[model samples]
Structures are given as C-alpha cells and as structure tokens.
Target chain A: MFLNLIRWFRGFVVFEIMGRFPERFINLSTRQGHFVLFSRPRKDNFTAALLLCDYRTIRPIARKSGVRLKVRERHGLPFLLGKYKARCGLLIGLLLFLIITVFMQSFVWTIEFSGLTTISQSTLKEALAEEGVFVGAFKPTLDLSAVQRKIMKNIDEVGWMSVNIIGTKAEVEVKEKELKPHILEANVPCNIKAGMDGLILSMNTKYGKAVVSSGSAVIKGSLLVSAVVENPSGDVSIVHADAKVMAQTQRTKSFVLERKGVFDKPTDEASRYRLRAFWLEFPITATSVKQSYTSRFETKSVFLNNTEMPISVTVEHCSRFSPNIYSLSQSEAQGIFAVEDYLYRLFSLSECESINAQRHYAETDSFYSMDVLYECEEDIAVYENLVVN
Target chain B: MNRKKIKSEQDKQNNSFGFNIKDAFSLKPRIEIFDNTSAVIDGSCGVLEYSETVIRVSLGELSLKLCGRGLTLKCISPTSLIVGGFIKSVEYIM
Candidate 1:
C-alpha cells in the first residue's frame, strides 16, 4: 500500500509492449532493476506499469528486446497538477477554505452549563465572563484548569466544576454544594419571651416551667417561660423551653402620601435589533432611545439545520418616560388609603386569630396621612438563648 | 512428480529437520497451494506460457504447469507472485 502511494506521488505510466517477444522485454526490464506491476499478457502484446522515471530509461531495453512500446495510461500527482494548472483560482479557494476552517476552530462559539439547581445560569455566566471563559473566548489562550480553580475558589456554592472546550462549544459542568438546615432545633436550652407588650390571652407550655399565667399583662422582652426547673428539694434542671403564648397586641402605623404624587409616564417608545456573531455585533435596526428610558431585551440564537450556531439576534424595546407630578382629589386620596390599609392587613395579620382595625385620617397642606390602629390575637413566643455558665 | 515424492520434497524444502541452504536463504522457488484454489510462488522465475485454462511457470530447474479455468496472475513482483484460479491439477513437468 505504501509503495503504491509512492508510485502515485512520483507519477507512473502504464504502457503496452507489442512485438513478437514482449516477454523478453519484461525479463530484460526485471533484470535491469525495474519493477513492473500488474503485468497482463496478450498473444503478442503485454501491458504493465512502470514509474515515470523508469519509463524514460526503458525505451532502449524495449528496442533491444525487439518490442515496440506504446503508452497506455498516465497517473499520479504531477499529471493531476499539470492538467488543472490553468485553473489557479479554484485551487487557491480550496486552500483558503482549509485555512479558514482551521483558524475558526480556535475560538469558542457556544457556551452551555449543566447540573445547576439552586444557582442561576445568568449569575454563573456573569462570573464566568469575568473569569475569561465566556463565548467567543480564544481556546488556545484559555487556561481551563486555572479557570476551574478560580471559579471553585471564588464561588462558595460550587462544589465541583469542569470546563471543556470541544470544537466551538464550551461546556461547563457544575455540582453545587448541598445546603444545611438553618432553623434551630427545639432541644436547645432556651427561654420563651414575650415578643410585644400585650395582655396574655392563653399559655400552652410543653416543656420547662411557665412563669406567666393566663390573662396576665406582659411587656415586650419579658420572659413568659423559664428554662430552669426546680423541685421542692431545690434541685435545679436546665431544659429546652417549648411553649406557645397567645397575646392580644395593639399597634399603630401611619400610611402617608403627598397630595402631588410624582410618577414616571411613558412619552414615547422605540425598537431596535442587533445581530451578533461570535464577539462581533452589528446593529440591524437604527438605535434610538431617550436619555432616561426603560428597556426590554429579547435574544434568540441562530440555528442551521436544527443545530444552534454562534450567531444571535437581540431585539431591544425601549420606552421613553419622564417624571410627572399630578394632584390627587379627596376621593382618590381616600381610595389610595383604603388600598394601603387592605394590603397591610392582608400581609401582616394573615396568621392572627381575630383582627380589629380603626382608621384615622388627617390631611395637611402638602400631604395626606392615615393612622391605622390594629388589635390582633397571635402567638408571641420568641426564643431567647440562656447562658448557664 | 508423484505425491509421495512431492510431499517428501516439500517437507525437506519447507520444514526440514536439519539445515538446508535453499530453504534458509530462499534461493529457489517456493510453491504453496491453498486447497487447490490459488498458488503463491516465491522466487518466481517467469511466465513461460499463458492461456485461459493453462499457465506455465518457470522455476529455474523445474517448470510448473497450473491447469485451471479463468486463471490470472493476481500480483507479480521480482521475487514473489500469486496465481489465482480454480485448479483441476498442478503438474511438475520436467
């Protein structure tokens, strides 16, 4: 196989020897250190292939052996180059295509991440971009080991990370650290204290000793249950204080709004598009935006034959707006206060047993203020650690 | 040659128990027949006669006649050659 390739590279000629004793020509050529391949014999003529260099020197042997040599076919690289020497542009284009394909393979085109549960992809990509592993990063210049070490060191959540640049795709695989429970256990020795100043409605003590009885008035930061239990013999035992103390609490909060409210109003809107291939971006639509405008961005990747390419299209929709002040009437001001009171109750008193609210409205020259007094019954037990040194 | 003489000659030439000059240096023709289908001959002298049903190969001291149908030389080099065909018989002619 290797000899055949060398023959094709140096060029070879298949010729026919037509004479009475062409077999003698074969014998003569073999004796003179010439390799004759694929020798096929006819009645008085035979065909065989010889290297182009040998063909030039074998004419004398063919004559001496009383045989006439006629060229049958030609092969190999020199003949091929000679046949298409006039069409230089085609060859140049073929070479240029190879050079470009090799050059383009050195840059990263696509980036993908796997094994992400708690950490967001955008946050990781931002961190990766800061570490020089983003899309369009030069593959030869990238130290993937260093990048992995740096990312694993900087990000506390990533337990294991691997970056592989295969062809044009940069695949990042990550394993996040399993999170531990943050809530404290009930077995720890602690005391239950009153969270707010209120009248104690009920007390349900599961462990330790209860210090406050039902219907007792207590202030905020007052201890409702003690972790130290003592018997009649005066022997003391420290245990975890577990109890639920329901209290009727009264609190007042003010919701204020100026008569003239300032809000951003949209004045105009504009849209533009950008095309990105690798790191180079080109604007497809004219860029238009106000000095202070909110924008929405949408990006879609380009695909060819169901495979995602490096190119993408980004559409930016900007809404131009300016701050405007409008004066509110009496009815509008009352409606706004009603909404504020409803939301405060819905969020703050959702877990209460019962709720009673009283609204007091007051208006000044510049603003409107509403004071809401709330009374609700809820569990007010809070844990306080006890140091027994 | 007769089968017994040919077998003895082959055993001596290819796998002799003692030292042999022609077998050691590969100076003479070596013929290997594969179940009568093809023959690989090392030290191929030359093609003496060619026909569709018969091929005469020179082996210096002896001439080998291969009788078959559709006989052709698969490949030929200076020292080695392979003959491929359906063989009815192989004759060692004097």
Candidate 2:
C-alpha cells in the first residue's frame, strides 16, 4: 500500500518503445545506470514504466539506439493534482480537511474511568482536569506522570492512579484509599449513662452494677450502670461496663415556610453550538437571551473505528424563562409539613419499638409555622470513659 | 611447431580464474537462474534479440539465450542483465 503511495508521489510515465531492436533501447537506457520500474515485451513494441525524470534523461539514449519512445500514460501526484487546477475550492477544502484531521488528533476527547467506588467520578475528573488531563485538553502538552502525581495529591481518597493516553481518549485507573476503623481499647474501665433525658423503660446489664431500674426518669449524663463492681467477699474492682438501656423520649422541632415565592418555567430554548478540535474550541454561532436564562452544556464526541476523535460538538442550550410570583397554597404548605414530619419519623425516631407523634401549625399573614413532636421508645445507652483520679 | 609444443604454449597462458582459458584470455560469463522464474547474466556485452518468450544476450564468445513465457528485461546494465518471467530453458550458443 505504501509503495503505491510513494510511486504516485513521484510521477511516472509508461512508454512504448518501438524500433529495430527494443532490447538495445532497454539495455542502453539501463547501461547508463538508470533504473526502470518494469519493461514488458509486447507483440511488436516493449512497454516500460519509468520515473518522469528518468524518461527525460533517456530520450537521447532512445534515439542513439534507433528506437522511438512514445509516452503511453502519465500518472502520479503532480498529474493528478494538475487535473483539478481549475477547481481551486476543492483543493483548498482538501487541504483544510487534512489540517483539521491532524489538529483534532492533538486533543483529548473522551476520558474513561475504571476501578472506582465510594469515590465519585466527577471528583476525580475535577482533579484530573486541574492536572491537564480533561476532555478537550491538548494531548501533546500533557505530562502523564505529573498528572498522576497531582491527581493523587489533590484527592486524598485516591491512593494510587495512572493516566494512559491512547489517541484522543484518556483512560484513568484508580484505587481508592481504605479508611481504617476506630476501635476502642479492650479491658478499659468505662460506665454507661443516659445520652438523652428520658424515662427508663428497661435495662440489660452485661457488666457493672445497674444504677437505674425500669420506669425511673433520668436526665442526660445520669449513670445507668457503674463500672465499680463490689464482690460478695467485700472486695471491689473496676471493670469495663457494657449495658443496653431502653428509654422513652420526646423531641420537638419547628420550621418556618415562606408564603410567597417565584419559580421559573422554561419558555423557549435556544442553543449555541461550538466546534472543538483538540485543544481549540470556537463558537459556530452565538445566541443571546434578553430574559433570564439557564444554560445546559453537552458535549458530543466523534469516534472512528472504535477510537475516539478529538473533535467534538459542544452545545449550550439556553432555556429563556422569567420567574412568576406564586404564593404557596395551604395544601402545599401542609404537604411540605407532611414531608418534613415523615423525615423526622424515619430518621429521628428510627428503630423505635413504639412511637406517638403530634403536629401543630400556626399561620400568620406573612408565613406559616409548623411544630412537630415525636414520642418514641429507643435505646439511649452511651459509654463514658472513666477518669482516673 | 609440433602438437606437444603447442600444448605447452597453451598451458603457459592458461588463467587460473578464467574458466574459458582456451578462448584466449576471455573471462567466463556467469548465468544464474532462479527456480525457472528469473535469470541473471553477468559479463554480457549487449542484447542481440528480444521477444516475449526469448531473449539473446551477447557474451563475447557465445550468445546467452533465455527461453521463457512473458519474459521481460528487469535490468540491462552494461555488463549485467536480469530477465524476469517463467523461464523455460537457458542455452549458451558457441
């Protein structure tokens, strides 16, 4: 394939050598140390293809050997390009296409990430973009090892990483750092106390002496189990306390909701397109919205033969809309309150054996106020480190 | 001028490198054929005849004839020639 390309680049001609003895012409042409591509004997004449320069040099040799050389065909790059001299635009367009293809290869189009969990893809992309390895980034100017080091430095969660560039695509592989668990020291003396103010419902004492019984009201920091263990033989010892103290608790919260607000509704969307060639991105057209508008950016990458191209299309869609005033209806306010009340039940009162809730709402001319109360039974066991005095 | 004196004189002029010492100090022409497909002739003076199936080269004392199908002269330098085709046979004419 490359040989034909090279042959075309250097123009060649096919000549028909006809005379008394074509062999003499062929021999005399080569006897001067000139190379002929090929010479085949026909019925009466021999046809040989030679470089155009060689053909010009061998004209006298043909005459001296009594053979007349008639050029049968002219081919190669110069002749092919000369045929289209009249069409200047096509030639210019071809040149431009070649330049664009070369330029597009110098940018990174698609970035692929693998071996990431717990850590987000956007976080790593941000870190990589800071280190010059993002989409539309110039590929040639990137220092891959430096990019890896910077990314590792920027994100503490990423323990190790590598950046590999294959054509227009950048492949990023990462291993996330594992967090070590905090474990309390064993055989340490401790005490169990009430983490919140609640009435004691039950007790499960595993170690130490129980200080509070069922149905006893206790406040925060009130010890339910003591680490001082007294033996029947009149000997006392300190031990690590372990206990589960179930309690009934009550919680109250309030929220204020505004009565008036404005929200936007998208009316008409206009898009601005940009052509991205590697590191260069230029707008094809600009769109201006007089009203308030929100923009959404999207990049469409081009691929050839499963390999990504650095060329891409960036579209910024502008949704032109203005905010309209609307007051929150009573039912909408109630809906918001119901949602908040449900969250409270799900998060605050979670794992409770039994729960009772009361909701109150007070409305003024300007805003609405919601008060939520939750009554529930849960474990309020808290471990307190013993102070050695 | 007896036969023995003539033999002794010819022996004195014999060349160790030239194969054709009898041809009066003429070096031997070398013809190499490759798998009946191509032929290379060294020490050839010029081409005498050319055709699609036959090519005759002059080697000072004899003409090196090549018989083949679709024969073509791949190279024809002053002292060497290369023939490319399906070569049927090669002959050296005295």
Candidate 3:
C-alpha cells in the first residue's frame, strides 16, 4: 500500500512535469472534460515524444496498425487518470503560492529601536545602515546591543542609548544628556558686602547706589550699597535696585594648633595575620574588609536632578584614613609584602585610577586606627548680584 | 456498404503503425496503439483497435458504445490498451 501511494505520488510528479509542456504533445490530446497521453520520449529526441488522445476512436486505428496494446483499468485504483488530469489545476495554483511565499518572506517587514540618544531618527537609521542593519536588513542576524554600543561609541554626545529588536523591527531609544543653563536668582534686596575683610582694591558698581567708593574699605557683613533713596522733595523712596558692587578689603584667616603627644617607647611584640577565603560563600563571609577609619570618606555624588535616581552613583571619592604603621614603613622585610599587596590592588584597580605615593614612615605600635584628613582649597571667584527693594 | 468501404480505405490511409486504435473508432477495439505521431489531419489524436462487435479509442476514459456493442478495456502495456467487445461495426473517428 505504501508503495502504491508512492507510485501515486510519483505519478503526480510526472503529471506536474509533463503538464508544463505546450499544447502540442505528439501522443497527447485534450478530450471532453479529460485528457490522456503516452509519454515515451525517444532517447535522442527526449524533449519531443508525447502522445495523447480521446478514448472514443483510437481502437480501430491500433488494430489496423497491427500494434498490440494494453489498457490499464484499476479494479480499485480509486482515482482514474482522466480525473487526475482534470485536477491538474492545482499545479498552477501551487506554483503561484510558492512564488508568493518566497516574495513575502524575502523583505524585512518591521524595524524597532531602543537606547537612542539625541540623534535624530533619520541619522540613526543611516548609522544603522553602516552596520548592515537598515530598514531592509534581515532582522535575525542583527546584534541589537552591539549595534547600540557601536552607535553610542561613535556618537559620544549620547549619554545612554539602547537598540532592541522586537519581532522583525529594530527599536532605537536614545537617552541624551543635556546640560541645562543654571539660572541664579538674586531676589534679596541686600548690598554686596565684603565676603572677607581686606584693603579696598577697586570699586565697580553697575547698578544701585554705591555707598563706598574705590578707596573706601569695608568689613565683613558691611553693606556697600543701600536700597534707600532720598529725592529732591525730601521724600524717601525705597526702590528694588540690582547691582554689582566689587570691593577689595584686607582679610586674614588663620588656624593655629599646638601639638602634644606623650609616647614613651610604644610597645609592640607580635602581630597576628588572619587569612580568610570566601570560596563561593555569599551573604557574609569569614572576614569582612572593613576599614577602621576615624573619619568618613567624603565623596561628591550627583543624582539625576538631585532626586534619588539610581543614577547617583559615586563621582568624586576622597577616602579618609591614615595608613597602617607597618604599611607606612619602608622596612626591608615588610616592604616586600607591602609592595606585593599594593601591586595586587593596583592591578585590580587598573580600570579607575593612577596611584601616586609620596612618602614612607615608620611609627610606634600605638594601636591607632587608620585616619585621613584632606585640606584641599581652590581660589574660587563667585558672582554676587545685589538687588535692592 | 459504400460507407464501410470508404471508411476502410480512410483507415488504411490514415492509420499509421503506432496510431492509437481507440482514436479512429467508436466501436471499442480489443487492441490499442499509442502513436507518438499526432493526427496529421488534426482531430482528437490517438489509436484504436476494434472488430465487428466492439470499439476502443484512447479517449483516456470513455467506454461509449456505438452501433451496438459492449466493450471492456484492459492494460496490455504501458502505452497499449487491450479492448474486448461484443457485437457491431467499428470505425476510426480521428
């Protein structure tokens, strides 16, 4: 039965291949609602040998030709050859279907984008074409994240960007960092007093009444301009005047400290070193590397608009700690260990810093914890716009 | 009689060695030949073989009786039809 089915299928294939020929096959002819053909191509003329006819009248012709013929009528073949021929209409339909399927699957139908920047849509689309991911690209092979990273790297103005493929389309969403201009409001009707006491350098007043001139000296918290004005009518009128009053005054800020320490032969004999391995242990470990510092580590972290958006990762970091006595000392034997340890830390921190060392010292074992104090200052020039009401 | 003689002569002239025996007669023939040669005169082309009582034509599916006959068709070869018949005249139409 299986063989018979295979034969039937093979016959179908044969019918399909032969059905493609034109209307002039030799032993082939169309009939009323049916067609039959003998397809015996001569070896040399393999393209030309097919004959068809109606069963109504070929009998006597064969008899006169003296050709012995056989008629194959299946007792249970179920489908007749004539019927099969009539159903050959499916061939054209199937061909059309295959052509349409191939056409539909050939082109890219959609595009999606993610992680885009201030880059415009058209610019991003053009950039995507450079990476072979344009409107018509085959979506499956496109590495969206890689394309996003490429775009972000190429356009550094982009603070954050992403490319995502949803279905057959690429969705590019960009997060652009825009620096907003700061608007400083000097709404208080106050005079620009001396920030620090110093000798009068030169006074420049763009607006408002300047009470002190270039040679005049002013003290801290002393008002240089007044918002009160006396007119010719002897009427006192208070106007909200805005001004820039610059005065140079003599200033002095000093810090004096007297140090005292009573250290008579600090005692240290033995030190114990503990080695703890986490070895995949999580949550908490055998030992935690917590620095015992007396001072807090000062870091300036900026949040997105100062509102706790996880964007507030650390920016500037200045740790507060004093070094370990042993680590501070350049002692011959301890120096090796310190050097090795520092080398390991330096290797681990290669992504974030360039280390610089200034000094080496040896201290007594007073059991003092690590402490760091920073006194860094910058000569900052600030604009003080005074407005008077 | 004249019609029969004229049909015989026409069969003699048109029927080639490989003509489908079923193409020329309505009386189903006992034998059939698949002619690679098409009908030189352009009617439904095939072959036929028949006796006085039956007709066989390579219409691919018909067993129509003409001039009184019952005919049965069987496969003798891939390109042949063996048609058996009962009674009456046979003729080649194409």
Writing each residue's lDDT as its tens digit, candidate 1 over A160-195 gives: 999998888898999999888787576789999999
Candidate 3 residue runs with Cα over 4 Å from true position = A1-189, A199-202, A247-389, B1-42, B47-94
Report per-candidate DockQ: 0.31, 0.51, 0.04
Winner by lDDT:
1
lDDT of each: 0.86, 0.85, 0.42
Query: TM-score of model 1 relative to the true fold?
Result: 0.61
Best by DockQ: 2
Clashing pairs in 2: none
Q: Is candidate 1 or candidate 3 better by lDDT?
A: 1
lDDT of 3 by residue, A60-161 (tens): 433443443344332222245455677777867888899976754543444454554456777777787887776456656777678778877887667777
Candidate 1 chain B weakest lDDT stretch, 10 residues: B14-23
Encode model 2's per-residue lDDT on A1-389: one tens digit a residue: 89668878988998898888777776777778666667888898888888877887998888898989899999998788889889889989989999998988788888989999988999888888878788788788999999898888878888999999987779999999989897755589999999899999999998989999999999999999999999999999998888889999887889778899788777788999999976678999977665467888999989888766667899988887777887998889999988988887788677888888788998998898898787889899999889889
Worst 10 contiguous positions by lDDT, candidate 2 chain A: A286-295
Q: Against the correct fold, how does model 3 do in TM-score? A: 0.28
Candidate achieving the largest TM-score = 2
Q: For candidate 2, give the lDDT of residue A38.
A: 75
lDDT of 2 by residue, B1-94 (tens): 6999988777776767634456543567777888988888888888888888899999998898888898888877788888989898888898
Better of 1 and 2 by DockQ: 2
- Docking band of candidate 1: acceptable
DockQ of 1: 0.31
